[model samples]
Target: MTLVAYAGNLNNRANVWVSLLAEERRRRAVRAVAEQDHAAVWELVEAFMAFRSQSGVLTSVHTLRSYRTGVRQFLEYAAEHAVNVLRPGRDDAQRYINALVAGGKKVLTVRSRVAAAVTLYKALRWAEATEANPFEETFAPQDRMHALEKVPPYQERVVRRVLAAAQERIAQAQPDELDRATAVHTLLVVLAHGGLRIDEALNLEWKDIRLEDDELRLVVRSGKGRKSREVPLSRSAVEALRAYRALPRTRKHPPRKVFPFASRSSAMYHVRPLFDEHGVTDWRGFHALRKYMGSRLYENLEDFAAVAEVLGHANVNTTKAYVRVGNERARKVLRDW
Candidate 1:
């Protein structure tokens, strides 16, 4: 919302072409179509973007950019199919799906594209079969989906290597000697053991941690879906955190957010290098560390329900995917027989 407001406010007015800037901005919000069709598609796309914005999903400018790309493609599809009509041919729907696959996109990536199209479909749904309801026909079949590229399961050995490697990296680093290293490693444990999203991990405050207890649990104030939950702490995690807290805090510093960086980007700059040095592939993303962490917990505990609780997932199903056990593990047990 802040970014949206800032982008909205950019103008020279008497000295600059404010209206032209606004026109260009609006055009960016939708994908291109024929000159005659662009207006309608843009109008619909803007309304959808505005709705997501109001709901807070479109909070960041980069997020708006992603939405722009998705919605633009949707507009083209809608226009090509003449979605204004009550019934679009089934062929129209398949062609669009084929086009996405033809671009060499994975099923999951294409799923995101279809999801955006579905969102538009729902937002625009009336007494209409426009675009032959493309979403329904494409994703309803399990085999077709199975044939689409799926993320390969993270093998047990790889998952263990990742976690053990993280610990080794932390052991090798002298936190007191390196504040940036210390901060990044400490936060990684929070994501791994505390079952926190990267954003929530980054957003932690001093009050969120309960260190005095024999166990450590973090109170995540804002999480996905804007819901909150408490994540359990491990013994190693408690000790590391206690050590981190004993470090300096400025009088001018904010009460919350224990690891507030100069900015989110600066934190990433520090974290990325550490991941590169440590041989962990997650420097590019906090969620990858998150994925392995969940896997480690699930393998050890063999309890998806508990993992879900720690991860603050409303549904255990989501947690299961994060730390999913594979058929290979099941085969090992069967082989023992």
Candidate 2:
């Protein structure tokens, strides 16, 4: 199959996967072109992988996988242009980024691609080649971030209804599938109530649970920047987890992750399909949970600082976006009003 044609599905975007795969093979020659340092790229990635493994801080496998795609694309583009990758001067990096933007890539795409490039550059210490790391001179944030186009708040009912249907399917499945269903349900609760990204939800472990003053708390070990943060478990979340723990577990091993069967992949692997199966059209993925959590939390709390703590955000500015509480359904709101 042609490279793009081979990557056939939403699950992995086959074209990107195939391209990254080819890049992995080509990386050796890209680095140290004069010396044919074929393994230079691999060595760089492996160094990050090893650091992540040993330091227990630098790498989450989910993030590492993304770097694979981003850096591979950079190397692939460099190879096509006949640029000696291992020795790409700083201007070359600038051109590579500009070329991507010039080729009709959206701002988010451009930013993500640049971020990916930055990761590889940092991984191999490529940034030091520039007196100031030309990438550091990014004078402004990408348009995607500054321009806020949230899914309309009215859509919460759409998402919640869809989730409710997904719950019914879970409740009716056979015993074997029921375990998976229960796992799915538990994950849903984490998304719905705990406001966790799917990977954060999947990587959750029993040991992270701390009950203090009768309130349940969750400590997420793998987060952006590997910053460990705490999330308060709502009563529904607490009860769902308790019931989930009561359910039969697959791993005989103690203190492993919550969703043992889940792997390090995109969060959509869990959330997106539910919409397809239930026919909830145009639905986004797990980040909706953050929105749901943020909107709901604002009803009870006013300060973004508290919301930031609740959502595990490093920056209060990020938490501000989440705290905008839209008016709820008229019936729900007018129960006494």
Candidate 3:
């Protein structure tokens, strides 16, 4: 029976109808797998994502986008190589990984794509859509370097230079360009001080800013893993924000969001030139600012747990990766030895 007709007949039991619809989709997916229908299998992937969204298993749009990209890449590879994704042989996953490696994808990128495939198969199994688990035994190649070794935090001097460049742009901006300049500067200040993820900062509404007597804090309503935390703003950050808010353009009709850039890329377009002008060529973009904040906070507080709290890191170990040890400190310890 058509889903529409079935739903129409079960108007009284809407919940049951929904459940039946999901089961029907699962059955169709199973049939598609058995028939080796690539197009139908792609539809099943979409259905799996929809199911996760409906079930609140996936809350972040960024996460959904990443999963879609990774899964789509895998499916594309499978189709090109004439492999049935749902009925892959034992070596299919390894072959896919080998292809990615052959294409010179970074170790981290390869691992993330593999993880996305693994997640998709696990969800499909839970929904009874397919019994195939091609990626169950497959593993991505391990990176020889640790996270800290990969990208060190931006130095304090470099950060200061970038911030100064931003301030100069704000000062020299034309009347028509004043708002954009001020907004970018404020964003940089927040990133430098708040240690927030770029998404978290971009998503901030004016309501998230909490200002008390001589102090300022930002409320991140939805962070990684759908968690929420408050990060206290530094004195300089507070001043920058206040200055931005007091601008005639901002005061006339303040935007609902703190930074009114359309997307993350749009925001980066304004800030990236400043970074390039300065020698911060890590390519991590705004994240380097976050790492700078984490490292500075750890240096001052000397408390891993406290730094983790400020950075909204779930684990202290993750926070440690963000904090960089200075060469001078290492030299001092070695000299003592």
Candidate 4:
């Protein structure tokens, strides 16, 4: 299925995905598929995979890969049961879900797998390979409200120790790795202090950073849903970015991208080891930093709107989770009682 032809069926979502892939990759994908039965299915799958590989724009790359993997597993299972993935009925979808649940997969895993199946079936429906999305009618878990999973922010001491260690690592970098070290160090500061998502940091451009008259602002040009917002930079975060920008390699010919890392995951490639070195095993990755930022902003300022604006949370409900009382603080108070 040619991209133009596929785009006609996919509504706007396919067009967005296609634009994210380079022209060469999009054309290559269109030409790569062989003429066969269910060729459209393969073409759509290839297109989705290509989009997953190249663009972490709309969703995290890790999530895209996981969804693709789940979809492929369902395809294999369908082949064994003589079910046509392109034309699955509700019963066929239910059986697959039952198989997953029977195998003792967690509710979240089962829901993710079913969601992947629904995504593919939607593509098939667009391709006119099926009359409807079979997986749409299938039962799946609905207990995934993020509020229930909320926890207290990391202890203030641990937060300080992690940021301090990041700076120490940058100071210790070898000559050849100075730029890389600066990049990681800047990311640590921005993520923890600025509260930006991993992708937002990775997608930041030189044009988005404004350092005028000693005031610093980072504009997120393309946040979730392509929304744009400008966040004030913490003084320390600004200092860290300045130090990174001043590196010899950076000054020589600044890359269009502000961060040196290629992708979101690659940006944090060094973070795991750093966390381990700091003896902080329980620390969640970037989200923990964001939560800490959100919590502090609310606790200090007592402004829901301000916290929401800075964190880029579309709903105040999401913002409210960050303000929940810290576990360590609660323990300390109870220790005296």
lDDT of 3: 0.76
lDDT of each: 0.59, 0.63, 0.76, 0.71
Tens digits of per-residue lDDT for model 3, 136-233? 78868999886666776778888788889999998999987898889888898898889998899888887888767554788998688777898998
**Model 4: clashing residue pairs?**
none
Which residue pairs show backbone clashes in model 3?
none
**143-192 per-residue lDDT for model 2 (tens digits):** 75422254432256765776686678778988777656666667777877
In candidate 1, list every pair of residues with a backbone clash.
31-72, 204-257, 205-257
Q: After TM-score superposition, what is the CA distance of residue 253 in candidate 2 from its true location, in Å?
A: 8.6
| Winner by lDDT | 3
| Per-residue accuracy of model 4 over 140-192 as CA lDDT, tens digit each | 75656554254456667878888888778778978887777777778888887
- Tell me how many clashing residue pairs each candidate has: 3, 4, 0, 0
Worst 10 residues of 1 by lDDT: 9-18
**TM per model?**
0.63, 0.72, 0.84, 0.77
